[model samples]
Target: MSEQMIEIQTKLYLYDLANLAKEHGFKADDNWEFSMANNAERISIQKNYFPTNVTKIVPEILLQVLNSVRTALKQSLAVKDAPDAQSIIADELNYLVAFNPKRPRT
Candidate 1:
């Protein structure tokens, strides 16, 4: 894959991971705070969000999700009756939507 495609894929994976984390009641913040006390002086520290147990599991889940997506894309592309790009996207969206926790099942 080209560099741009890899970048896009990484962004998508991170976006999905963030949404998944939020759904699980984890905070998705751009900034995280820490504190230090030394020699009777208080020090304030700020950095990006720290990884929790949930964040640690994200990589494994993301890899599985990406693998599934890749398999689906390959299968869709290999069909003798080729599906259009829109159809492929719609199918994938429907697959994802099926997992919505708030959606009422028929």
Candidate 2:
């Protein structure tokens, strides 16, 4: 897929995740940023989250996100001598965590 297409799709997917996270009480401090160079893509979210936050999200949505990440990771690795594999996966992992919910107001 073209880089532009990937960027658009990734953004949309993240948006959906953010909305779902909110519904489940995940808190985010900022937005996601996308950067690419030499076929290496980096996606970063402003805050960090926890694994429990992920469990709080709907299982179906988590499954969908997992699939999308797997596909994107696979596509990136398909390139000959891919250098950004670690970076890509790391960013995806961070994105997942960024949805960790904040403690409820007392």
Error (Å) of candidate 1 at residue 95 is 17
Model 2 ranges off by over 4 Å = 27-106
lDDT score, candidate 2, position 13: 61
Report the C-alpha lDDT of model 2 over 14-51, residue by residue, as the tens digit. Answer: 56656755666544453322222211111122223322
Best by TM-score: 2
Write the residue-wise lDDT of candidate 1 on 1-106 in tens digits. Answer: 3545544554564566456557655543332111111212211111222231121112213333433444533322133543344554433321111122232233
RMSD values, in order shown: 18.2, 12.1
> Where is model 1 more than 4 Å wrong at Cα?
27-106
Candidate 2 lDDT score relative to the true structure: 0.37
Q: Which candidate comes out best when scored by lDDT? A: 2
Q: Tell me the TM-score of model 2.
A: 0.28
Q: Score every model by TM-score.
A: 0.27, 0.28
Worst 10 residues of 2 by lDDT: 37-46
